[model samples]
Target: MPTHSVLIRDQALVTRLLQQYLHLLKTYPIITKSVTSAVLSALGNLLSQVLESKKKRKDGQSGKEVDVYGPLRFAVYGLVITGPLSHHFYHLLELLFPASAPFSLLKRLLLERLIFAPAFLLLFFAVMNTLEGKTHSDLQDKLKARYWPALKMNWKVWTPFQFININYVPVQYRVLFANLIALFWNAYLTSVRK
Candidate 1:
């Protein structure tokens, strides 16, 4: 087989797969996004654990056993919370600020970064706390200790990305774009929660 022919075949295969995924998204938007979020969130937690293990080995410390439940918790959170919330949130943004509106881009960015980002972080901490079986006091303590720092970090990291995502990405693909970025964001979140 010619090399060019093989390359074309591979591209065709990829195109077909993408088409199938888009069809699934159109048919079952929430479910598709939920499953995608679950898988990516789990992977993010696993990546964080792997990096931590490597760091431990480098520091001459005994490696801790991977917490098998960590990824599971993230998967559940992604499915139950992140997917549904993001899907709707993006939709709401579009409704609130149509593309033709003046300053729509700035409006969406401000709403997302100023309001949604902080609220979402709090929700994440609270939900993860509950999932971990921690007490209300523990949740409060966590907020006091971590919320501001995390929010600050979120503003720094997600501001520009959110701007791009809201303004440029198509509505249908917004959740997927966010999820891809959240792969690294989730890892950072896991580290911060520790």
Candidate 2:
């Protein structure tokens, strides 16, 4: 990377390095999408703050750069939430459900709605909040008071938010379905809460 060398000399290189890592993880599909999002959140949160990365911050640059805290925090979410949830949903869909045409359709629908969708979003918010330096209480409240309500009231807007959510949900049809769900949830939340 052209920026890699330029970043090395600068003490302010922390943010750009993590940004590279975030982009790299998102570039792959086999990896859990939640993990990628969590890393991006970590980079965003870390970039906003000024903290020396591992060895780089302490000993100046010796051509070896290390992320100190940001990646660690992101990993916490990946391990605890992203990996486990994906596996659980995978088993639920592939193993537990019948694989017939109508049953597959219904099973897929149910897996997403009753199992994966809400769990994914909830973990996403939590990971994002952790990565973005938000407190647990703040994240909890936002989930209850802000995010759900935002989804409900401005479901139209929320649905549109899914267009840019391509990185997280790359299966085009699934992305479309998730967007529609978001729109409905947003509208529903608004009506009930506001």
> What does each candidate score in C-alpha RMSD?
2.0, 13.1
lDDT of each: 0.94, 0.48
Residue pairs with backbone overlap in model 2: 151-186, 152-186, 152-187
The collision pairs in model 1 are none
lDDT of 2 by residue, 54-169 (tens): 43556775433434564456456554664445544544554554454455645565445544555566666666576668898888777887566443444344334443332234
| Candidate 1 lDDT by residue in tens digits, 1-69 | 569989999999999999999999999999999999998999999989889889999999987888989
Look at candidate 2 and tell me the lDDT of residue 31.
Answer: 51
lDDT (C-alpha) at residue 175 in model 1:
92
Error of 2 at 75 (Å): 3.1
TM-score of each: 0.94, 0.38
